[model samples]
Target: MASTDNALKTASVLAFERKLDPSDGLFHAGNWDGRDDTTAWKPVTLREKSVRGTISNRLKTKDQDPAKLDAAIENPNLQTVDVATLPADADTLRVGFTLRILGGTGRPSACNNAAYQTKLLSTVQGYVDANGFGELGRRYAHNLANARFLWRNRIGAEQVEVRIQHLEKGQPKTSWTFDALQLSLRDFQTPNGVEKDINSLADVITTGLAGKGHVLLQVTAFARIGAGQEVYPSQELILDKATSKKSKTLYDVQGIAGIHSQKLGNALRTIDTWHSEADTLGPIAVEPYGSVTTLGKACRKPTDKLDFYNLLDGWLLKDKAPPPDQQHFVMAILVRGGVFGEAGKD
Candidate 1:
């Protein structure tokens, strides 16, 4: 029975806390053979360098004349940028970080309407009771095993290996190693050779999400890109365009080049094949609006009623549930967590 005060009314204040948390990945350099003993690896550091770049962008109509273009190329653009590369003696890059899988999915951090909140939790519980988080867990585990979080660093590597360690009280309970290149980034398919390891890792993550206290994991990935190859680190977004002299600023933590936790989270949640364009566009990071910033357009629009808010409201208020895939998408948004309260108008 719906409460009289809250029946058919959306909560004005609702929010869920993110469940999967990861620390910033720190970069280190070492010989590929020395990967077994990462204790001897050296911290990768950032250096500021100046490079002369030719003006190659399309010129304005007035400046397109041959004489004008030739003169422009002579005065090359000098760019001061930050760069990180493996030391001459090191042929591999080591990135390491810790991940914490939290519980209490679908439980809002804040909600004023108890009735609405109760229904939401019930809905989430129903999904867990039925699905067991296997699909979601498998995709996340796939991302980790494939080293997708390495982004550009994983590209063009001669070889890549990823190691995941389940931690208990600062000690490893179990560990798994992956030959990352064999795993495809375009899909979450666990190859026959590595299915056992992938499933084991997924089981741990799904268990944590099922409210089994919490789970901690230590992750390390090695990319053998050859000695002195330039490594890519997360670039800091500069808001003050005029004040900064450098066009690019690489992220660092206390002088150690690193990747942001947000970036890692994005990579982990790239499991949304349920979107409308799954036929063409492939997976994107789970989002309420199905937004891919790089594409500059939304895939799950309200017009289609496939977005988070529409599906959630219909499911909760109208007794209308979305399709199975959409139901999974809704649950993923709840797992990602955000302020989803409806706004009031005067």
Candidate 2:
């Protein structure tokens, strides 16, 4: 139990407005430069195939015919298709969102909670001044530049392209293409090595944070699910309603896959929640007499309550606060987790 006196009482949410249109784009990977190509947005279709099994003692016990089994085996069996390519005319998804510090500069009322405001305000402002929302920018850039927004990216997606149109004073419309599988977290670094695209994205975010403009980002994703030699789990594995056994159909076995626009919208919501690394401190339990520690070593007693700002303050004091990117990532997640409002009070 952690003490409530030092708890975090306020936070800001970085919500984005989003839209998905599956039918808008030519569905293919190779036509990225606005060229007409046949490979773009190709639909994946699955054809049913027969299953072959060998006759055995179990079949004999069931009075199954071995001759029929042999005949079935002799016929040409359909090859298994584990993944599918998405067809053109598939709905293309579009997400519209902005990133900004909710309570900074012109939005003092954003952090209206009286208890923690005085203490945390200066720190937050200092962070804004130095980092210019770099952490939030970096994460957003990574999500787009890496195609982390593509649900099928976990499978095999050749390309994930993001076309950005910024409505700002000095910036022009820009677009970037990324190899979905090749983008990594390290690409968001300040110097960012040879990846000029990521660096440009970082600059865009910095401009947004500086109040120069808002970003309009449209993402187009193209993926091939079941084409290669690898076998993947079919989408049709379900419990049989009649037999209550695991069942599948040939339709489930093979085909191309495309993500729905609504699903793409939902994926973007993931940024709202924070995911922190596991706590290094061992667990602490409180008993009627005293405290028990997971390590079985001498330790301080547990507090009654705990929250993000408290931990952040402690870390800042100890010079152990995470880097700006990590901090922004955690904050976004915390906002999505609903850890703000009066309930966040210490």
Candidate 3:
């Protein structure tokens, strides 16, 4: 696979001390009076804890691997792995992992689940807890000794390898296990310069597409990549008879077609109108109309046009906003909404 300039490879280690049962591995919320010797405070204890594992990547690859380089070439799909991890609250903890192709290199088409390394080394999280009656104090322990990664290769050969060893004291040398393992890749841009590493990009498109000015796209989102650039939908379009045979109505459609209401459409339009007005008005000082207030106290109170822009800019840009001017960028987008201006002060 041809790697992207932003591919990153890293490992995360998490540790949770063991907890006692009955509380089911959670610390109770109520506060007790330590001064009241008359009352007994059910001594809350920690017996077991868990760590989540993740691996992310953003590598590019060509449609066909070079025959000469196939042996040594490691594609993003080849490195993505998924393993189960134990949950602290439940008797059985399960962890899920997946690999994704952020972009493509030589190949015009994108990559999927087939290219990852077949060998995955994962172990169930387990530990022993003993206090000798709580006076000497209890201990939740597990050693990392002999932890291994196991997976199969494309040729169907089973591969098992050790990654950590000796996790706990006074336990069987082979008793250590892991809950889950994940791998992801992405580019890392820094202030000193662009330092691209293999790290997994967030599934921001699916998770945050419902908000204003954002649309879910399949091809175009992957196509735009350059220095100091942002990801955005090429355009927004509604389905019509020529496009979708269902002939669903919009803004006031029926049944499944009408899942979104006219009230919402009008609200969206109002938001759009405000943004458009802001471009010329500079800023607004009026209370917002429609459902803007429903966002609750978490919404920023814009005192100027820039304030309004700053508020919605994060939502406009799916990924993290660039620093220094990020706030300025945010204010600028909101300013387009025509909702606020420089004269407004609240």
TM-score of 3: 0.16
Q: What C-alpha root-mean-square deviation, in Å, does candidate 3 show against the real structure? A: 30.0
Question: What lDDT would each prediction earn against the true structure?
Answer: 0.91, 0.41, 0.20
Give the Cα error of residue 265 in candidate 3, in Å: 11
Model 1 stretches with alpha carbons more than 4 Å out: 1-6, 59-74
Q: Candidate 2: lDDT over CA atoms?
A: 0.41
Cα deviation in Å at residue 56, candidate 1? 2.3
Candidate 3 yields a Cα-based lDDT of: 0.20
lDDT tens digits, residue span 75-177, model 2? 6533332343333434232222332322222223345555455545455556566766555555556655555545434444334445444434545477666
Ranking under lDDT, best-scoring first? 1, 2, 3
The stretch of ten residues in a row with the least summed lDDT in candidate 3 is 119-128
- Give candidate 1's TM-score: 0.94
- TM-score winner among the candidates? 1
How close to the true structure is residue 90 of candidate 2, measured as C-alpha lDDT?
A: 42
